[model samples]
Target: MDLTTRCLFLLSCLCMLLAIDLDAVEPSYYVDTSSTSDVIDYKDPCKAAAFLGDIALDEEDLRMFKVDRIVNVARQTVQTVNRTDPVTGSSTNEAGQSSVVPNRRGLRRWKRAATSRPERVWPEGVIPYVISGNFSGSQRAIFRQAMRHWEKHTCVTFIERTQEESYIVFTYRPCGCCSYVGRRGGGPQAISIGKNCDKFGIVVHELGHVIGFWHEHTRPDRDDHVSIIRDNIQQGQEYNFLKMEPGEVDSMGEVYDFDSIMHYARNTFSRGIFLDTILPRYDVNGVRPPIGQRTRLSKGDITQARKLYKCSRCGDSLQDSSGNFSSPGFPNGYSAYMHCIWRISVTPGEKIILNFTSMDLYRSHLCWYDHVEIRDGYWRKAPLKGRFCGDKVPEPIISTDSRLWIEFRSSSNWVGKGFSAVYEAICGGEVKRDNGQIQSPNYPDDYRPNKVCVWKITVAQGFHVGLTFQSFEIERHDSCAYDYLEVRDGNTENSPLLGRFCGYDKPDDIKTSSNQLWMKFVSDGSVNKAGFAANFFKEMDECSKPDNGRCEQRCVNTLGSYKCACDPGYELASDKRSCEAACGGFITKLNGSITSPGWPREYPPNKNCIWQLVAPTQYPHHPAVRRFRDRGQRCVQV
Candidate 1:
């Protein structure tokens, strides 16, 4: 009972407390209670048990999953998964019955195979995909953008199919959204991008499965990262929470990533509202990392693919106003088997100008082997500006949008010093907003000579584009043939000309007939000035509204204003905002004159004008005998 004995006892008690603390934090995984002898069935994966509500795993990939168990899950479909809605908000059922489901913040919106087959990896990281004809133009655009999302971040590239035997065909089916994991050998493999699956993130997630990515939560080491709530999981969906063994699939030597786009949402396959089927074991200060991020690829997801495909980590998203980038190992020979994508985004009102300073790569007829491709927008499928190879440097490429996407690819056989380029944000770009402002390049300062800038403004449907000049100063011209501002009523230059203005006088406000408006400003080589500034806004429909422009009779909505009109015998009132009776009446005043309705402008058609002259009937004054001009009309009087 001395000091040594007491200290030793206290140390033993502390050790016991530490052991209990460790056990409290340890993660608990799903325990299999079903018999091991349970037979696994193989069938059309898309139609079989592999179709877990929204995900469809192929038979080969399905085998890697352990299915002989009852895992707890619940029905907590986030408001985001109402099936009919792609956005995250309250939605209604087929009977128009709505429920207010809580929104899963940051939950913006997959599976893979085993036995790594080289064929599973697209040849040369180039994939060919076909969009079904049944898809609308906007749906097709969404598919392309989904494909481009991967292309913009990884070495993987997508091309429209052209008689390729093995390719991915995107189809629309109302049978839930799903995609096969990896390439299905032989003919075209199908990926269903069905109703409510047109979202960018959802489509991207499906494409990830096509690119041979397994769900992050299914990793062999996922037991140490997440715990599946079997009671909350949907019945018959336990296979979704099963983990793959170590030998079945490779994790590319990466840690379990909770934010991977391939990871499922916390509430996925839940049986009731607010129930989470998957919960993370680790948290930073008690806040778990969000899963199922459909916005973009996580760092781990990108790294794993790059490592598996031997793709280079060279590209970056450049958002600076001005910056420079080059191919991997620029000025020095770049390694073979390289695929890189660089996206440049600037302010909304500015455009990007990319100029290559040097170029060197293996040249081919189509520049197919090794080349640098430039797109006019951030999407890889955007209009191709050029595909350059060899020693010659390409011309400056200007973007129609505020962004640009560039890619450099090299084959395993050839190597080169590669290319270097710089991008600058300049004036002019597309505008699609309710209201915004646009200014000339270096406005308030003398603009550069021999410059051409185009501005396109698009408002909401059923709304017209209205533009007003805030300030105006361009080179003087008689016919606006020199430096001037040209405006069009439509989205293209071929549309009807609205006005061409120059000199000091500011032109009047302009309103388009439709939702689109286009403008171009040109400066000659001889002269330059402070240029001009303008504001654009959406013009609402005045006549289509309930009040009918407050007009008594008919209301006609023009480009910038509304006018009131009366019946055949009536004309517009003096107030200009009302309709009044007018076609024919008695002329009692001697000093008054007679004319057609709506003079100065075109007169209304199918109208008969009749007037009775009764000049007091007392002093007719020789019946006002005077010469009357025919005025290009024959008078019939009796």
Candidate 2:
């Protein structure tokens, strides 16, 4: 080879050596704290949380979650120590080699969780990610593999960030591997996957932290499943072993699983191989396999994550004969314009009994707002049970039909904690008998706040259902913004509303126009009073003959009585048997557009025109103009 060609090769080798030397000299992770101790550095997502001092979980907030361990930084610096390879009989010097991460690695104890404190489930199970430019090609590939592992076992999908408001940025910094719990809305989260931290299992563990699962050993029930050895832990890391309170963390009903990928290794945080930290409890059943297997996700890990994120089963869909489901962001505000529909079915003959754990939604006195509507069957044409809003949970709803299709909807303006409900198909409840009485949930006692309940009373065919509230006392409000009861005729909500009674007064005895009657009661977030109780009995509200009110367009029957009525846009003629429409007049549903009769063509030279508009009783008719610009046409007030 020529000398010049050989020189170029040597120069390239020199550059490579220089890069390695620089990497070896990098400083260990360190933090400069402004306070002396336990000041709760909670405000910084970039820093570990200082000890919050024995803040045990309280009974009232069992649904709330909080992590006790911080992304702590051990206060030491890495120094080289001599190591001998037993197999090769060779000597080498390695920096901070130990069973657990060296005390100097600083960033410690993976923390990934968001207390119902303040979190919302990600939409569509997608998580956007970012990678710092400094990581080498090999390191970047490890990050991708970790993410793909999660995608393979679960519905979670991770993509590169592009103008996203929140994302995880893979950064190669001084801190040991660590990631902020769940979403911290203020900005992007930085996960430190530093040098030597890219092992498959370690990378997967850090990614788990980003998705919101706490370390398996930290679970409150860990004691029943595993024994924690305290003496083996590194110094000043007592906070790292703190266990969560019962219910403070949810495993999505998964059994204690030592095989979970979220489980810490037996020697995690230990000073050396002789010291181990986690041991699975032994039982009559048998001993279990070792934990901290970084190979892939365990069954419990995948199931819990799927349940927490609202993917498919677990809690999202209820196909079982008896089951329960909650809003998408349970224990948190459901997002705006959110729509979730659930179908519940029972055996060929049984009916469904739905009970609410809690319900809080945006409120509007006019009913022009967020609501959860229930139908007797799966189609849109199926009868609507009732429309409910406000902060209150509704009373228990019973369906005479064997199936129920429930849909939850939220408008764009505001949102609340939404609702949580459970339904079980009953073999023989009160409604199954066709003639029975119904009571408010927890009758004779103050109803729980934020509740919604519905009961469908059905009588045999050819007979009508009569209902009366025996005892009633709901929070008094002119519009019932906080709590109220609605009764409807027939099985659907489209059935005519008989009465929307609230206040302290008992409603008068009423009878249904058909064989079925639906009763729905809702309560707000505050001020729940003793609710009402109603009795159901079958009777006929039928007519012997049909008569168009002396001869008009139509006639209606009201249990033993009849009345005549004319369709909209027409009025009874002088003879009462005929009808006439005013010039340019027509009738339309509440949601429709109106235009001049002449349309896009020219009108006759001399003709006077007038029109009338009408709406359902719940929403009084109002003149609408200005800002109604969908048609690109001109309109004027008559």
Candidate 3:
């Protein structure tokens, strides 16, 4: 067999043994890196013109321009058969892969050759690009997938070019995959996607360069994390491993991330097939970290990108039951001319309690400059609880419902340490005290929609609950259906109803028939209004008024109502109200005797007799009493 046939057969066999599907293998696997063999060099007018070194440019400019060179397929193995087009000096390999010659006219503008320079970022993290018609349908899909991978993790966005002055042009020229670092001011910068460069990760890596990321190994602090093996590195490619000065690159306060997609594999730029140009160091735990992961953006990479673009740590949506949030750059004076908003939401039927731990901001009488505004609702238009500034921390703010909106604004003139705050979800409970106050969630302020809160006020038995409304305003409804406060006479919802109050009308005093009172506030998923507030206290004794209990004799007051009692010589009648003459009396002396009504004669029918015997000491003496009746009636002793 010929050398190519033998190579293919061996590779197919190896794939089968490894359980790898060769058909599913990405074209990046076909990269050729052998320096001994000749590879096709696609000559282009742009590359040649720049290589000629225009007479207008001086020595240093040319050197820097040379360092800004772009390449396709950064690091890969070499194994290919090249078929060159003699006329154009351009050729495709056995896998139909070719190299792209970047448009070098724009390279003259880039001066930082070895630094991880923060090149001009896309405005607002919005990038405009145009995909060349030369790409096949599937190839276009790969490009989109890579773009989406970056967008999914970071705040960066990619859109088709419109009339923007600066945009990216995705071109297919049979060149290796490559892209310029950061956005170029030129009219149309090109990101070349060659034949074998259509792999998802390869495209993603190239785009990382476009998004202003340097190789991970070039980080200033990389030496502490990775060790470079100079002996294994290719002789002329040593510059690729050089580290940037500490001040030149920004790590965004993140530690070294070995899994960054921008990182090179251990074998990158190796002098031999089996040589490794880079080796990871043991961590504090004596464990080595894996490197060169082209699967997705690393946490460090995402953080750095976000920091460069100022996309996060500015505003967020908080939904935890309890959490804390602060202004951007809190405790370290915030940036000038900044605006940030935070929306906090907890479980429904609950309320939010926000507490400011610290506050330091530019002081203004009207708080028109740098200040933080808090609202009882979830939007900008929500009722503003307060707008605070200066060194004084604001009072604790409680929401009427489960959501709160907080905003921070800073003027271009002054800034301070900003503020810090924490929040938690709070809601209904049982109030069993003698007298206290009860109000709707976030009463005075507008209540939130779609919430139900219950409050059970229970005092000592026999004491009726008295509630008086100080202020009342709810979502107006004729039937008190949308949003209303329902008061029941007992502790449970099934108790007898006192009243359902709603709208702007204030309810009269509520006095429960029993000591327990049940209150439930219900709000639908619609409009909201300021809820009601009321104070509850123990009402006066029900039997305090003269003859209030309708008793024919003495009256006694209980917790919630009244009762009747008979005098010494009288008995309680069957009607339970009238008092009748009785044969019993309280005997305070040493001894006493009692008899039935109309004693010596036959006692009246159905007459009740009673007597009380008492002694001054702890031990009391017992007295005997007898009752006499007519025929068939028996005499009983007490």
lDDT of 3 by residue, 1-638 (tens): 23211111121111111112222212111111222111213222123211111011112223333233222233322332254323223334343444322123332221121223334577767787776546654565567668767765666767555467777777765335555566655466667777787888888887877776657776768888899998898744554675655444456557777878888888887889789889888664566777777778778777777666666456766755678988888787789888887777554346789999999999987998888998886556679899999999888998875568788889856767889999987656577776655656544346667878898888888778988675677888889878899999999989999999887767887889888889998898899876766657676564566655676656765433456766554557777777755543334444344444544545566544444444555444543324333465354433
lDDT of 2 by residue, 299-415 (tens): 887777766665543223343556777777877778777777666644323467888888788788755667888777533356977677776767888876556767777775675
Per-residue error for 180 in candidate 1, Å, reads: 0.3
Ranking by TM-score: 1, 3, 2
Lowest-scoring 10 consecutive residues by lDDT in candidate 3?
10-19
> Model 1: per-residue lDDT, tens digit, 241-311?
66655555566556778878889888988898799999888895689888878988888877766665666
Cα lDDT listed for each candidate: 0.65, 0.57, 0.62
The top-ranked prediction according to TM-score is 1
What is the clash count for each candidate, in the order shown? 15, 23, 12
Q: Give the residue spans of candidate 1 off by over 4 A.
A: 1-45, 58-115, 316-324, 327-354, 358-419, 423-638
lDDT of 2: 0.57
Question: Model 3 TM-score?
Answer: 0.37
How many backbone clashes can be found in candidate 3? 12
